[model samples]
Target: MAGPGVSRRRMLGWMAAAGAAGVTGASVVGTRLATAVPAAEVVTRQEIRTLTPDQRTRFFNAVKTLHDNNAANNQYNRFVLTHYNFRSQGHGVAAFLPWHRKFLRLFEAALQRIDPTVVLPYWDWTLDSQRPERSEVLSSAYFGGNGTGSNRCVTNGAFAGWQVRYPNLHCLQRQYSGGSTIGSWYSPGMIENVLNTNRQSYDQFRRAIEGSPHASVHVNIGGDMSQMYSPNDPLDWVNHAFVDLLWAEWQARNPNLANTYNGGGAASSNILAPFGVTVASTLDTRALGYTYPRWSGSSRPA
Candidate 1:
């Protein structure tokens, strides 16, 4: 792995590696290099087809299309749960990330094919600091409701620690707070199977949004995009471009602290899906290599 100080040099190597061979029906999305051109030369924004006032409306429509198509194309879409049991389902556990990773890749690809250079956005919950529930961008496609509505509360399953597996599970109003490290590898001495095999997932997400000048992050609509998020919409094209950005942030801030989790703790079969695997029975994010950038001055596209 390239050290923090040498990422820029590594990125240049990636760009050269990508161009070494001939180009056919290939995608440069996951390439390690963050697509770079001098800032002044980058055409960051695509032509906004819809009026500024109708941004919400337009995004909703596009998301609706994504969900509907994903469901129609894959039989498993109906079976996939919103938050749990996904990794252990039909395919072997390892197939989980690669499968969805491929799915998300195709999903975003389709979006871009329709509109070259349109990148996947992400949800930066911090911006809505004043009112945790009511952020500026609200669409049923990904983010579920009016910030003031009933669904705003997180009220089910693990929220109520009824399950013996997750001792911390408890049902309460849906919270947009920090320390949501349950399945997240923010604990101590946990095995990180995913990060171990593939650390480049970070670089892949970084390059996918090469030309986008701002973060277009948003929430998974209908609480879980897996269920189509709507009656007619089946495939959910929900993705956060800032996933990489956040990882970088956390890595930088807490370099000494990996995602710390306790081990030997058994989780209910139900909740296993949210977290990909039971690596080391519990895994830590820092050891696995991840961080969230301070991101104070980062820009969000208009």
Candidate 2:
């Protein structure tokens, strides 16, 4: 096992080993990996709406540590700013999904460092698209409801009274548009269109998803959720996790193109700082050691 991170030299060696492992007929079309090395942990990321009470506790506790622990790059707001500063490169480019995948993996790794039992959970926004506010994950017992007062600061739930020191000192806030009601996000049909279509390359799929639900959800949450520092709200993790899930599903559906990377920067381009993973190494989620929960009798958003 490579532990929390792998050096570039070591990763290149792994890639060479993978290339030399085999060259089946599938390899000609880029459909399969030459080597099928298993990852040490096969963590199954579940839906946030479905997490058990204990699971929620573990998640919140890890986040609390990350938020309060100044030793980690000067608390959590710095992490949010890390993403904010590099927002352009990660979005609307070939690196969108892979960059976020690497970010989440690093964040999850950090969480595991605090509480090894915690794995990142996803939010299937479509499942609660019709009445986003009423979703179980937003209840006072969970992530809590919208903010109150002039600043629109969240005053209830796990993150209540929390202070952050990036993009100005402020409390974690959210202003649900349309009078505390978030409009419906992308439907299952829209997602199906992306999955069913022949993307031809990675950039096409990246643009499609990034334009619709991805941007839509950001606007839906408004306030801090819409800014470059969206990660200031922990819910962004689950939101992006769903995006990553979409990517994983798309990759699984089109095996031949699963490993494809095109447009924007080159494959060797660094995927932001803190994470030394190259654009190419982030292609295979299995190689990264985790996966989204598989959908059954469905193409996307189970």
Candidate 3:
């Protein structure tokens, strides 16, 4: 909000505000926290934690509140359409990678808004690819039995690396079972050029989070049909949060990654700046910095 460098006095004022927020946030825990042990270091496992049938119902219902629609997926609807329709004349630019990132981000924010204590647990695909990557949709992995709804892996690619070929994890060979739209959520590449193509290893992750992409654990926006960015939509909040996590992970990996997402251009949607937050908004990672994360606060990133 000020100059390139904020003074220590300004920083203190912000911290003081964060401390008060922590107090108010403590009152809303799910009680389940006291009884539940944190999932064992599942980070490397990428075990897609499926929400239980009950959790699934709750999660879906919550998402509907924001989108003003029911069951975002239709029988013929596939979130993975990005890989096909972009740039009719030229080869698609990892088409799906950007759109799906945004959709999932919106999807997850809808989830957390309802349950602040909830964290969108990632389904570690590395450990459980055997269960059929298609079966790992959040609904099934977390809760079990959504019936292998969609496909995530692909049969074709330039490199065997799942990250590179699938980008955000989608391949033409991968098809959604409940009609074709199911596999659409998987993204196809380095996403934005700055994040993937133009950075040092560590900064690469942080920069990848441009504009409305990275809304949730795996939720990234894919289709970049229009350049206009509007914060009026919840997707804006969702995308930034998703990117924030990736940056957090990047920071963890390098510990010294250049912690910022400040450049803007035709390539950079830079959706985050309009909201007036920082690369590290959460003393714990809060969006819009409205409320910092606290004991039970979901706004704070883990």
Candidate 4:
């Protein structure tokens, strides 16, 4: 892993070299060089399409391994339940950011347990707003295509014919709004406006981002993605990662309000359950030991 000072071009070069050398199975120690990128400090979450083919394969393989390992028990069931069970407290409130941060962290930890090389990559939906169907992230080589048939079951992508055993017994499903087509995605301009909010509190910023592109993406995805069990579709994690990235960016930009908390009124602080993390704990990416590829004020695409 490169140091925090390493250039983005260098980082991509390293990843490309790893992929070209067929070092997907290489140990973490083998990937690091002397006096440069630290052995234990190589963690980075990137845009999904930015990942090399090998990296993508490793990611999907780990997810599939966990899925098959807990076939009868259903690994995704617990996560989906956790979200729905706390729906009232988690969404449209101050807990929304902290709760999702913890949720994604846990899921990312589970992925790392299976494949140490896999860091959770996010899907920047804004980039796909112009022509979503043409986006490589949704290609057959990746997440597959839109759903078909009565149940709107997804029959393509890496997770084709996948079974989701949460809430009910069923095949993994998706119902694209326009037959085999996807709707217009959230624009980068909208995200820029949301992030540029001069709000004095976390909820003010949270409500703006959540109201537009955030909720818009969920509803646009439809089917399982529109429900509590949205995790059934792997895209849910990727989407949430982007959302969390935005929140983190908002925090970084407004240092004065970074520690501000108004969660659950005076009775309760900004404490998020399960992980028991406060909103402040979720503010710094370094404190969480991970960073997005483009977080440090370069979040907007030029």
Query: Candidate 1, overall lDDT?
Result: 0.28
Off by over 4 Å in 1: 1-60, 69-85, 88-103, 139-240, 251-294, 297-302
Whole-model lDDT per candidate: 0.28, 0.69, 0.28, 0.67
Model 3 segments more than 4 A misplaced: 1-52, 69-117, 123-133, 138-202, 206-246, 258-273, 282-302
What TM-score quantifies how close candidate 4 is to the native fold?
0.80
- TM-score of candidate 3 versus the correct structure, residues matched by position: 0.34
Give the number of colliding residue pairs in candidate 3: 40
Q: Which portions of model 2 miss their true places by more than 4 Å?
A: 1-39, 69-73, 264-274, 296-302
Q: Which ten residues in a row have the lowest lDDT in candidate 2?
A: 25-34
lDDT of 4 by residue, 1-302 (tens): 12222233433432232123211211211111111112267477888888888999999987787677434344545566556555555676767777787778777766777788988888887787766667787788999867779998889899999878665668788876455666665567656766786467887887666554666565556677766567778888888999988887787788887766667553135566555556666666766768875554335332
The alpha-carbon deviation from the true structure for residue 265 of candidate 3, after best TM-score superposition, in angstroms, is 12
Which candidate order results from sorting by TM-score in descending order? 2, 4, 3, 1
Q: What would you estimate as the lDDT of candidate 3?
A: 0.28
> What is the Cα-based lDDT of residue 167 in candidate 3?
19
lDDT, model 2, position 104: 81
Ranking, lDDT, top scorer first: 2, 4, 1, 3
lDDT of 3 by residue, 1-302 (tens): 11112233432332233123221111222111111122322222011233455654454345334333222131101221221222121111221222333333333444456664344434322122223224434222232221122443332221111111111222222222233232222132323233334455432443244222232111111111111111212222233333444443444444444343323322243332112222232212222222211111112222
lDDT of 1 by residue, 1-302 (tens): 32111233433442233223332211221222111121222222211221243553444444444334332222222222221222232122222222333333334444444444444444443343234334333333334332123533432321221111111121112222221310111111111222233233333322322211111111112222212121122212333223334433433444443232122233222123333434322222223222222444333344
- Tens digit of per-residue lDDT, candidate 2, span 47-160: 886778899899999999878843324446555755655555576556778878888877787787778788889988777767788887777777777878899888888888
